[model samples]
Target chain A: MDRLLVVRCPDLLDEDEDGTALRSFVEVVDAVEAYCPWITAVRPGLCSLPARGPARYFGGEDALIRSIVGATSDITPVEVGVADGLFAAVLAARRGLVVPPGGTPDFLAPLPVGILGNPGLAELLARLGIRTLGDFAALPASHVLGRFGADGVTCHRVAGGRSGELAELRQPLARRRVDEQRGGGRPGGAPRRATVVDEPGFWGGVGDTDVRAGRSLAAVQDLLGPDGVVTARLQGGRGPAQRARFVTWNAREPQEDSTLGAPWPGQIPPPAPVVVHPTPLRAELVDARGEPVRVSGRCLLATAPGRLSVEEAPWAEVTAWAGPWPSDERWWSRSRRKSARMQAVAGAEAYLLLVERGRWWVEATYG
Target chain B: MFVASPDRRDVDAPPPGPSPRRSLDRERDLASLAVLAERTRPVSSSQTRLLPVVPPLADLLPDGGLRRGSTVVVTGLAGGGPEGSGGGISVALALLAAASGTGSWCALVGLPGLGAVAAHDLGIDLARSAVVPRPGAAWAEVTAVLIEGVDLVMLCPPFPPRPAMARRLVARARERRSVLVVVPGRAGWPEHPDLHLGVSDMRWDGAGTGEGYLSGRRMTVTATGRRSAARPRHRHLWLPSATGAVAEDATGTGTAG
Candidate 1:
């Protein structure tokens, strides 16, 4: 069994709200770590330090005890008890007793069963004429299990000071902290250096931390809306400035990059139109004679009209006309919505014109 | 003179008296020294550290750029502008471009539907930027955390926070030395901004229906606040000039902003 030293004060452990006991516990542990670096776990009133390596390093168990007593002497009035395991050490510390190696079970049996702090079990044990740990242990193990179930068995082991397993070790923030005073030049105690996460291309690592954080962020976004999140989806459509549109991030049916495979047409000050109406507005495309005008498949106006009014603009003469660029999506489907998108400029203002199903729509106004 | 020369000690002693010429010369030296001191007086270096704006746009800022730890209110037309959509929002993003490039994270709160393209085109690094579309009731909490962690936080406050809450946020931003750019909505600002930047008279380029492509936009940007004189400052800007970058209209009229 692994030998442990538990340092605690019984009276302070039960005091609630005021964290005076916890502070003293940490102070005692920090002081002990200076002399013996093999400190493991700490609690509000109890701390367990494995003593085999430190005992050998400091010459003997007696010398190690002297050193620990000297280190935390000025802090809290502490009881340091050494035993084979943590549960027994804590019990021994309560009584200020030290058990010789392999003598933990024998030393523990005579102690009161009430020390385990399980009220219901302690009350039942008292009723069963088992006031002491020895009486509890003397009872058949299978009988205790049958009566009190799993909790009774655990209490029985702890009362016997025969806990066979070591508690799991905790190492949170173990790398980020260093005690310069106690471990000035210790190689293992050096400050943490930059890791792969600091590198620009460190995203290649499996289960990347950034990606994990992004997943949580996306989850938050999902809680807010059905749309995954608004992302910039730049398009290679005729309108260069309006090429970027707010699209909901969909896991399925993602929009293809409009310009990814094909060579981008222009460089700076893109030639495509700047403003795109994400949701095209329905409007009337009239002719010069103030009548609803229609343009045929070849983009030829049937009896050219003189007026252009989309989104209720003052019927302005089309001072400039760009293109009837064909904008067709899902042509094969019966519900295919196809239209010819045209750019019209009237005195420093540009409008996106769409003719679909014999109806007109103003896609966007550059103004 | 001959009698004084006869006794060398007496001549030397008697000559040791104040003369008008020497006194006048001493007074002249003192006056010249006073003038020299006045000419080299100490200059005030009270100008605070600032977040960088592009060189052309810097002139439009009161302190030549966004002031650190100071909240600047940027007001733009609510919905009516020749320039398509939130003009003030665009200005706010454009101002943060330099700051983001300096490797500071910028969080945009209360702004939804601001796609990545326009921000990218305006030179903001979206990799280091965060956009919180709806910060409803947790706006103050989110703003506080963002300001504490990041160097710059842009909040579009939909309504005025409680005065005490607003003061606390301002205090935290000051303590943390982070720049807070608040785009006050119709409710107005809870606390007075150190600097106020407003945009008006925005005109779009590109003419006659489809005759010419929408090339660029020009807006008149006005800046005024407590630190500046009561007189408002003005400047004309081609927000996204022909080259697709913010530049000042050199021909446009303006005093220093």
Candidate 2:
């Protein structure tokens, strides 16, 4: 009840900081998560893990504290603090000290109110002759409410170093572990290490959007399960949106040296269609005699398409048509997909048809 | 040099003894506090801020620009308009330019054709805009996230949201004070939006023969506000002028009569 383990990684925000720093921090976080199930990320550089469970395993509080410092010493210097609650623990971590048991309130009383993290409240408190946490805690609850409704209640509670939300946070961790068990992973046991990285939304490398293609975005949300919304981050590749991917939901940087970044040896056709199927649909592009139209190796149409029929619909007369544009992509790579795209119109509907692997298919509808 | 502790209620002042003047001062302080709270109440609780659209297309809106926390349903009119056209996207993106220019973020949910290149070309800050082109059944969830963080979120949910889900999203957008542009697709449409925009008289210009390159198009955009008494206002806009940017047709066609 009177111990907290604060993990600190300095140089996290240094201009030269890179993935090395992040990786090291995640390693420290992961190592702690292996022992303690409940953790609160204080900031990018600091995190607080409850020591109640780990202290028993290591035999004592001091033993648990030493283990944490000892575990991360090789990677980089980390400062650890053990105190009554989050407020005192964070303060002690900065000073590299451990407050004695039942002394958190006394330790917090002398500290300035700036530690509460509310700058405007701190400024108002300073102007109200409350310089230290002790002075802040002395103010009448009613007076604080009259001045600053709900917000003042929190500052007053924290200034007194009282145990707050952290006591309730443990319940959720235990619940999640039980929930994890239903997934058929070591059922009914101590839930596996509960790390933030393992959290459903916390980590995403969502790349392809298959469901979005060829159907409504919500049509197949059930298909992707927890990944939920799959967005394409146009990476440093460019053939079409189908191939242009990098994997963050928001990608704006124009990928350099993309395939046919400018016009390659051949002429680049017009801009892409509005809707493109993530997966092309099988279809037939026939000439007047109903024979499948073919594109020669020289990228010329052997026979003009007289009619088009999509798998969803029967033979529709040609309203209008354009293109036979050849798309020879990544021919240098081991896996290459080459296709000829044609923009065709039929009965007020426009379609982007593809001819790949010597078979014709409807790629997307422009309408 | 200090006279009589210039302000008696100052932080450094000694605890006060009972005095009529001090009591009156406290009352005045309470009165001012009440006034300050009234003046600076949280915006969404009472009124919402407005999102400013680009100037050239401003007149097309009932308000001078797009109003925040309100949904604008945009679609192409079947009669007297280019049928099965992509003009709605142009109008929506045009509405986006002003907000994105000033660094406000815009998110596109389940709406495809969010071509980053095209958005950038139309004066949108590509880095600030997030595109969830296919959010699937998570349309409401995805839109909620964007609406919470971004100034404007454009959602083209394939099916009209169920009444319950639509109500929830509408409330969320209003609570967050962000604009939601809903272009409902085949399945259905959301509940009535605050503003309705119909694109009519859309025609491609600048391409005369087989020789000249494709330039831009002109569209008569009409806006009717559901909550306002102002009559529907229409303006002919070059959604993308020859320069590929939205410009109000000041020199071309006149405003709607």
Candidate 3:
């Protein structure tokens, strides 16, 4: 989970037919972008940006939040808060609290389960006398899977502060509305035509191939919306997912590898995994006795793993294995994570498994 | 196939009748004209028809490169789970590496969170590559749209295509002179491609029980195809060497990790 700073505007949460609220939200985004260039328009009234970089530049997270609130308040009442993930950060913004870096679990512990937004799960939990997120988080993950299912397991992870995202929290149409507002009043509901390929090379002359590709890609954006087509830009980070960022593809701006060569300590040696999952898949690694294998406090494997099963699929024999390489990221902050990565090979396939808080996840695959 | 070199500068250029230029200047003009002709020639020429592939993979292709306007299916073991492909995706990415590095545009459809670092290390030029990670129900349409302009379009269809849908895409690629590389993970392709590369015997090296890091993988790829590539051919390769680039593994002994 990223340390995200969310900006929530109460006045502009809903949109009117005249598009007044959306336009105002776009202005709010522009204002926030001036402080941090990479802010995401998560929804009509909600937006977020990674707080770590800007906090460093602006002296501290407190100052960063204060400045943003001060700036955006000129347009509308804005709430600013920083926490470990989008879900928590949004909650923090609503309450105007800056939860400490590693303190999300504590901050979220006392909250009602209703905040998770799954009415069915929340209702079911209430019936079982699990009224708060703390109670929900205390349930053993394996038990949650059998009784409540996958989505319940995800909510449990979120409640426990092991994960920070919930798919239900987002409005899918919000991003396109923001893009439409920024692109200057393109009608909200119209599907853009393929022939409306107006993006040309802003630098120098465009090639014939570029133009043709642009037209087709623009057509795809029309079909899948602007965020469908994307181009990856490599950046410096330890984890494979962190090493590259995917930005929605735009024909007007050509992609560049400007952030390619920065040093990252404790980075794993290549060959990198061919497929890095956006959201890691749950995995099970157990020893010969059928007991779960875990990384000890001393960072050594508690036992030899015998079989590996990913996403509840059929188990396969673990032919070869390596490391419990301790990746203690953000060690200086409250949000610091002490997870370990290991490579496990199952006949014909290899997987990069991550263990954090006694749970295993298949982070990437060498396909 | 008819060659379509449409240069007419020779006919349009001024005749050598009215004014006489210095011999050196005339020679320079002709040299520049030749360069221009080379630059403007259609890419569909007989010799330039094939897109370059890494040397190790070239021997498997009948044309020693990806022949333009051809469909190639890279297949891995069946029942290879959603995440498992028995190294089929690696082979497909390797095929794009050489072509993309040479400035050809490539688009990947239905591949989410592309390990771009892996692609970059494999010598792929990411700036020219476009990824449509999740095309959902519109995958065929998305692949078809991209095939119109992209030099190579790799499709990992989210679902098995009907024979007609498969034929249309294959025909579209043929007509557009685009290379279609399909990694039919489980949802199989209905049509036989121009070349079919099957991956088997996959093994990772340089790792033991809590010992070394994953340095590389050795796999056997068997290429069988139509016409010129009728005979099946198999080659052993380090699909991703220590540095994440493909290399020929001359030593047939694929040591297990």
Judged by DockQ, which candidate is best? 3
Q: What would the per-residue lDDT of candidate 1 be over residues B58-94, giving only the tens digit for each residue? A: 7767667777788877877544223233356667777
Query: What would the TM-scores of all predictions be?
Result: 0.49, 0.52, 0.60
Residue pairs with backbone overlap in model 3: A101-A334, A101-A335, A102-A334, A102-A335
lDDT of 3 by residue, A1-367 (tens): 6899999999999988899988889889889987887777777899889899999999999999888988888799999888998889999999998999999999999999998999999999999999999999999764775566445666887898866766566564677667766675456544422221223332212244565566567656756778999998888889888888899887647466654566788788999998998888899999999999989877899999999889998888898998989887632236756788999998668998898877888889888
lDDT of 3 by residue, B1-257 (tens): 22123444452345444445655556666776767767666554422578889988988988788988999999875545568677988999999888887667889998986899999889888888889999999898788778877888999999999999999999989998999999998888999999999988788998899999999998888899998799888888998999999999989835311
Tell me the lDDT of model 3 at B216.
98
User: Could you arrange the candidates by DockQ from highest to lowest?
Assistant: 3, 1, 2
- How much DockQ does model 3 earn? 0.27
> Model 3: residues >4 Å from true position, as ranges?
A1-206, A330-337, B1-48, B253-257
What is the TM-score ranking, best to worst?
3, 2, 1
Highest-lDDT candidate: 3
Ranked by lDDT, top first: 3, 1, 2
Q: Please give, for residues A4-68, the per-residue lDDT of candidate 1 as tens digits.
A: 87777554454356656555655776788776566643444556677788889898877887888
Candidate scoring better on TM-score of 2 and 3: 3
Q: Which model, 1 or 2, shows the larger DockQ?
A: 1
True contacts kept of 1: 0.13
User: What does the lDDT read for residue A339 in candidate 3?
Assistant: 86
RMSD of every prediction: 19.3, 18.2, 17.4
Q: State in Å the error of residue A257, model 1.
A: 15
For candidate 1, give the docking quality class from DockQ: incorrect
